[model samples]
Target: MDIISCLPGHVIDRILSYLPIREAVRTSVLSKIWKNKWYTLPNLVFDKHGVSDVASEDSLVDKNKIVKIVDHVLLIHSGPINMFKFTEDDVIGEILVTDMDRWILHLTGRSIKELVLEFLTGEEEEEYYKYKIPWCLFSCQSLHRLTLQWCWLNPPKVFEGFRNLRSLDLNLVTVAQDAFENIVRDTSIVLKNISSRKGN
Candidate 1:
């Protein structure tokens, strides 16, 4: 048996967290001891380099593959997801929103601590198409840090705030004056850092 495998399970999980998510999952093939160890990995990152399968000479990513990969991982994930980061610039119009909504719905009850959702597009088209984040995201009280880029933020009228959220980073996001006021003015939240901007 390897010396590293003998280390405590928490130590192993910590070690795996440092590796790229793809490499971390590949560790399951190393041996029986490592099998399924990644299922409990708290941090999940889905980005171009990590999950993309370039489909053609044009260098476009296969969106369907990415969606399937996310679905499979979340379906089998066994423990609370402390952090989930998803960055995809090639997400097609409305399809991406559906998948994102479902994923957020799944993560809500899992006590996710940090959430990052970024979708990049051509600057000209960006203003016309901003992802409206799923309403469930605003209800996630476990979120400690939230970063959203190139999306529209319109929380429900009854929404209060993320009670545990300490940091909020909004880049190129559009929120109505009333909605923005409601989010920042909540007494229940003591945000340590709040950054917002209107993109050109």
Candidate 2:
């Protein structure tokens, strides 16, 4: 009926892909055609502290809301998620770790190419713990680029995967020397570039 609405579904999906995850998701309510477009988006971002300047109470509410939104997106997303980015906060606590494991496991089922996971820094409470990058990541053969900031790395003894990985960046991550070497040894064939906070 409308010129904009008549555009090809792929074209529409491409256009919607550029917008922020939240804004893109909102477009779903515009009509039935656009209702499920968000689910097919290949890229999804969840920045937990989007409203940092807001009051303390409001920020907590927004953070919790973000966690719930992430749950829904990862669960219902129907298309292959090429990239996934999320910011973790300590306020969410131990529950967030379980949720992240589940999320990563879900992504492994698809052909994910790029993964960026950053944890919020500054609070002393959150300082006590760092979310360990799941061992399952080593088995993700589709992963080409990976980045982790303020997270922990514990490579498993049986680690053997990421043959497609080309770039890896680990910033401010606490990792054992031998464990780190193990990761490099496994991916040395295809991994060309790697930078970690501990080293130059």
Candidate 3:
């Protein structure tokens, strides 16, 4: 008898959730009981750099692979997604932005809590162009922590701040003072830490 298999499905799912997506997915080959177990994970971290071992910074192959893997994983995800972090960009294919919005909108519908959007590509301008967050994020009351780097922040006029957000970290991002003020004034977020930095 397999002792590990005796554990509840939720407990095994929680353990798999902490592993990197690649590792988590690879576990499906272990046995019948392990097949599709990762679909229950609530946390999803899609870091492009970690997705491959390639050392070349300009590898379009890596970028394409990252996009394909992300699309596949999100499509098969069956359980509630509590957190989603996507941090990377470079010569994105024609459908990158549209695909990203589809993924972001999907997570929003799942009541995602912790969201992180970081663009660390060498080009700052392209990063901004690719990281335009979805409109749904502004009204996502389920969000509890948000971290944005090398992206623009344009909270909508009718935006009510993240009601559950406890931490906000923005670095090298563009955010107007008025939009920020609206969130502080209108939203009930008990922010524990709020820090932002600008690029030179």
Candidate 4:
């Protein structure tokens, strides 16, 4: 039996948390005791740097494969998904809207505590389209930390703000002044910290 496999489950999870999700999943092949350990990983991150490790830069931005990877993981994952971070470029942002919407809808049901979605849209001068955040995301009461980049925020009418959100980071996001004020100034929602960059 492998000595490392004898570590406590929480310790093993802590070790896995430091690794890229792909590497974390690969640990399942290490031993019987390690098998299925990755299935319950609370944090899932899919980003350009992570994918670049597996494929060339050209194939790294393959949005279809990115969608499939996210879809397949959420489809089979059995436990709670506490954190989900997906960072991709806006090269194919239009086509990925539906997938992004679906992914958020799926994550909301999992009691996601932290959600980060960054769609890099090249330079400041370029007028790339922004992905509008799904209304379902605002309803995720479990969210403690939320980060979004290069996206539009249009919360629905019935939208009450995230009750449990503690930190919010927005970079190059588009939101109506009133809507933004509603989140920050509203008495119902209390955010301990907020960091926002340029907005349009």
TM-score top scorer: 1
What tens digits encode model 4's per-residue C-alpha lDDT throughout 13-37?
8888888877887888888878888
lDDT of 3 by residue, 1-200 (tens): 47666668877887796788888988887767788898877888888534755335655666666778888888899988888888775534455667777887888888999988777533554544535666788878888888876665777678867777877777666665566765555345554435443322
- TM-scores for all candidates: the values are 0.86, 0.82, 0.81, 0.85
Compared with the true structure, all predictions reach lDDT values of 0.78, 0.72, 0.72, 0.76
Task: Please list the residue runs of candidate 1 whose C-alpha ends up more than 4 Å from where it truly belongs after superposition.
Answer: 52-61, 186-200
> Best to worst by lDDT, what's the order?
1, 4, 2, 3
RMSD of 1: 3.0
Clashing pairs in model 2, backbone N/Cα/C closer than 3 A: none
Model 3 alpha-carbon drift over 4 Å, by segment:
48-50, 53-58, 89-95, 121-130, 186-200
Pairs of residues clashing in candidate 4: none
How does model 4 score by TM-score? 0.85
How high is the lDDT of residue 173 in model 4? Answer: 71
**Which lDDT tens digits does candidate 2 get at residues 1-200?**
66666778988888887787777877887777888888889988777433233225655565566667888888788988999988765433575778888888888778799998888654434544677778787788898788887776776777754678777777666675567766655545444334343321
Model 2 misplaced regions, further than 4 Å: 48-60, 89-92, 122-127, 186-200
What is candidate 3's CA lDDT for residue 39? 82
lDDT score at residue 162, model 1, on the 0-100 scale: 77
Candidate 1 backbone collisions, by pair = none
